[model samples]
Target: MLKIISNQDFDTFAQNAKDAPRKRSHHNLHEQLDAGVQRLFISTEPETYMRPHRHSEEHKWELFLVLKGQLDLLIFDDEGNVTERHSLSPETNRAIEIPPGTWHGYACMQSGTVGLEIKEGAYIPTPQEDFAPWSPAEGEDGANDYRDWMSTAQPNTK
Candidate 1:
């Protein structure tokens, strides 16, 4: 069977990062995709920041196709160090494969930046993600704390 989801239908799946801790993963398209693959729609503001964390179970990778705006894909090591960064813009359609156990987070460089995320999954109850110790847990500190860490934290030598 062949299926086609229009822009309207896909937008319904998009989710907000701010509501994630409340267990609201915003506009996600997990059910629409086939097994072993889940699609998610992510939209964020400039001040929005996802705390540093890692998914160790699945080979967690994502293809972020920017629908609009800009973002910074910040990757970290086990010690919560900023290892690499990617500045993503809507100028191109691209995908970044993030390996499992790579601590990562994102900062919205511009408001209303929407991304289409595709990844492998068979959802589990517990978080396959391990949050970095040095990073503040969501709601514990303001977004500024995360930004500060990124600017000041030493890079991983490994």
Candidate 2:
């Protein structure tokens, strides 16, 4: 079956993200969790907080392409300092590739933000050891504040 990705898919994802408790949603394109390559469309609202994390597996480099709205991809150092920040939007910077073992997270800059994420995987979720020790976990008291800071975080800053 040929699955054509259309505008309607994005619209539905956006609506789902708005309704989700975490303010984000994912629609997997890959048929199964064990698929060699994982692909998905991620929809996120401005309030969504993606806790900083990394894929420790050697082959897990990830790519994200913004298809709608905007977001700021924040790359961090081991000590939790922002090492790089890339603002992505369909009209400007559109994509980013994060290497495996790199600490990173993103903050949605606009509502209805949608992006395509692709990575080498068996779709294993990030493990506890891969979550940045210096960052707050999702739903933690400082998670929102940390997410807000990421929206404007500069290189060399914590």
Candidate 3:
């Protein structure tokens, strides 16, 4: 069967994200967690906190494409210093391909922001070591501050 994603789907996703405690939600297109390739539509509100982390598995490169609203993609050095930033929106730079082992995260820049994420996977959870040691984990103290800094951080400035 063919699955269709429509504007109403996005609207519902946005609403779900808004209502969720984490301020984010995803609709998986892949039927199983062990699928060789994983694809999903993610909806995020501005307050969503995605801590900087990287996929250490050799085959885990990830791609993100903005379907609506905007997001700031932040690339970090091993020391957790900002190395690069890209603004992605439907009207402009809409997609990013992140190589495996590259430290990165996203900051939602608009309400109702939705994007498509694709990655290689057997859906292994990110090992704790893969999370940036210099960054706070989700819901930890200073996470909000780190997120605020990520919103406007620039390369070489931090």
Candidate 4:
């Protein structure tokens, strides 16, 4: 079977994200395709907190593309220091390629924000070595603190 994803597809995903408990939703476009590489669209609201994590395995690489709305992508160093933060929107700085073994996270900056995520897959759980120990897990109080900083964080400021 052939699957074609259009703007309407993303619209529905974004709508679902609004009411999603985790403040986000995903529409997989990879199942019908090959297994090694996975592609999907993730829709999120401003409240979403994407915990900082990295792929310790050398083969794993992550890519993000803003399909609509806005996002603040934050990159951290090995010791959990803020190294880079970039504001991205569909009209500008739409795509980012994250290398393996890099700690990173993002915050949705708009009501209905949708982004395309692509990576090497077989869908393994997050390893303890890969997940950042300094950052709070999803839904934790500290996570909200991170989210708040994300809302106001600039490119090079604290």
Off by over 4 Å in 4: 32-34, 155-158
Give a tens-digit lDDT track for model 2, residues 1-158.
Answer: 99898899889999999999999999999999999999999999999999899998888999999999998999899999998889999888998999989999998999999999999979877889999999889998898898888888899999
lDDT of each candidate versus the true structure: 0.62, 0.92, 0.94, 0.84
> Each model's TM-score, in the order given?
0.71, 0.97, 0.98, 0.91
lDDT of 4 by residue, 47-138 (tens): 88888899888988999999799988888877777889887897789999999988888988898898899999877878777778888888
lDDT of 1 by residue, 12-73 (tens): 43344344443223465666534578776676665555777777775665566666667677
Worst lDDT 10-window in candidate 1: 17-26
In terms of TM-score, which candidate is strongest?
3
Q: List the residue pairs that clash in candidate 2.
A: none
Ordering by lDDT: 3, 2, 4, 1
TM-score for candidate 3: 0.98
Determine which window of 10 residues in candidate 4 has minimal summed lDDT. 149-158
lDDT of 2: 0.92
Per-residue lDDT of candidate 3, residues 1-158 (tens digit) = 99999999999999999999999999999999999999999999999999999999888999999999999999999988899999999888999999999999999999999999999977889999999999999999999999888998999756
Shift of residue 95 alpha carbon in model 1, Å: 2.4
